[model samples]
Target: MNLGTIGIWSLAFTHGDRGEAREAAAELEDLGYGTLWLGGSPGGNPSGDLATAADVLDATDRVTVATGCVSIWEQPAARLAAAYHALPAHQRARLLVGLGVSHAECIDRYRRPYAALVGYLDELDAASPPLPASARIVGAHGPRMTRLGAARTLGVHPYLVDVGHTVRARSDLDTTSLLATEQTVILSTDPEAARHQARTMLAPYLGLANYREAWLRIGFEPHDLAHGGSDRLIDALFAHGTPEEIAARITKHTAAGADHIALQVVTAHRTLFARTAWRELAAALC
Candidate 1:
């Protein structure tokens, strides 16, 4: 469950294309990163999503691959269970399935979202091809879901979050459970320019209620959430500065009790994997 450091969280598929999700995975592995995390897809067949992870597992030898999460509403438990069973036993350990009960608006056609996830886990447990409980993680934010994650999966993968929520989530789970947080990084020395970039990049999450509430809990004011984000909000969530400063931000998440901190470089540069942002941060942290 120790999904390793400096993974890519590209929303590239949204704006354009991922080429092959596995191609990015292969490059990330070659970059010396320890994991490849993919998400931002609201709904999709679980098997196909799991197959994406499988492609990465097949392409690389060391790095673990995870869904930053796949919506429980979109995919069935049996589907994920089958995918988990299809992989070689050794490969299975390297594939972590992160599940989530997504936003209500996004899950409109699904029945009883929370209950549905509980049922899905139950069905997964009951399935002929069940995954080891340790191979799956949950995308939980609030207390109830956090508790569910603690009980049902390996740990929690909370997105658009900070160390404060990481602290709270760690407290909610058993000490052994994993808490891998996603931290956004933009390597810019200018404070105004750094935050401007951070704000523009964070515009979408600012609209999600789950993220809005989580930011509020971390002391971000309602006004701070407006438009893009206030400078203060941007500064706290996005790690922007020198590479050393970015490493310091990632370290803060570890200090706050995160088992792993997924570093995302916020840039329009498609060649980010080959660029300085990833290399500099990787050298600094790992």
Candidate 2:
């Protein structure tokens, strides 16, 4: 997992046009982002599929393309393992599979999530050739899963996190494990405008218990999670303002113990190829 200091995680990559996504991915690699995280919503991809990851990997030569996470309950280990082997050797080399036990509210079969994740790992281990632990990542936030990620796979990919949680997660794992944290940002100078984009992007997540618990554990109060998140909550989770200001916030994660920061830029208009924002951020970030 040679993911450098910065990567781009895009929700639109999974939601928009594939051809455009491939082209954007190639450009991002040229821009110097180490990884391209396919940001799918919870219980999405319906079958725990890796097709989107495959598309990004096929388009780029060097940058690692990750799932951000595909749910265990949604896709079987054998099917996922098979999909991994289906890619060409070159593409496979640059692919990173991120797995998670998504929120119970979104998954009907969600039960004993931790235990289920353990079992899923077991199944993957039993697969033909197997999806190598070195090529996979765990979507973890809590202590137990964070430790599991350190011990089992490449490392943890924590989403919707603050500097406080990154520090604690690093403490839970040994220094060798990759602490790839996803950061949401809005490249806007106006406070009101930024919050609106942040809130719109945050509303669906607020209802998910997995992220809710992670936020609370990091010292966010119940009030912070209310009504599309409080100003304090929005401010804490999102990095807004100019490109330089946002870059500074992304750096906070690195200082707090993050090995890699997967940057997700949120804007009022949703599009897969967010070239302008990526280009601007790369000037300050990469």
Candidate 3:
């Protein structure tokens, strides 16, 4: 729903103190970001993602607030729909629900992920206050799921991806579907320091099958995924160096056919560094 060219994606806004999260959301809006994406997968609690979206929506006036992704396994489709309908029409219009099937390792009964996602969408469609496909996005990586996203939902929101995957995703989806990609950034000039921070954030992803397979398809070698990823892999997956450098990297994604880029600034202390990174990035990109 009009997620601008660039948006801030961070778990800090969803999992942090309410006062601080509200303050940060307002500040990002003031700084000219088009959307505020609440990162992190929601638990079984029905209100978890909705509460975070509400907090950010209440804090900012024009900026859209989206769940970078809510795991379908975590929250039921009916419950998610109920929560969406519960919001005032005005607020509901500004919120975008991004649903994901999550990883097999994380989910207990992760069989037939594609079928499960289709089933979840079916439930949403059958609900009393149906959650329109136009108002939601799917976390898709593979071709089949990407096609499903285009056919059933707004579009695909591919995470931990490079420009190559962005281009591929654009080709897979119809012109009407959106191609929103998540980009991790580290604002550090030192090569070693930036790689260290990038590796820390990437280590968990390397172990995830979906991410590793995606990386390989995008031209990464097997060794590139080992030992927390090679320098080439880190460099391609993350945008690091000066604000200008990071901005340039973002341009590559947009040039490759990405409609929107959700920028997640990597840091050891998320609460302390997120706003600071956003301020610097806004200056360079906004």
- For model 2, how does the per-residue alpha-carbon lDDT over 88-124 read when each residue is reduced to its tens digit? 8888888889898888888887899889989999899
Model 1 local distance difference test score: 0.74
Alpha-carbon RMSD to native, per candidate: 2.6, 1.3, 1.7
| TM-score against truth, every candidate | 0.89, 0.96, 0.96
Error of 1 at 202 (Å): 1.8
Q: Write one digit per residue (lDDT tens) for candidate 1, span 49-98.
A: 47666766887888877876777777777877887898898888788887
Clashing pairs in 1: none
Give the best candidate by lDDT: 2
Clashes of 3: 0
Question: lDDT-based ranking, best first?
Answer: 2, 3, 1
Pairwise lDDT winner, candidates 1 and 3: 3
TM-score of 2: 0.96
Q: Candidate 3 at 51: error in angstroms?
A: 0.9
* Weakest ten-residue segment in model 1 by summed lDDT: 10-19
Worst 10 residues of 2 by lDDT: 40-49
Model 3 regions more than 4 Å off:
41-49, 270-273
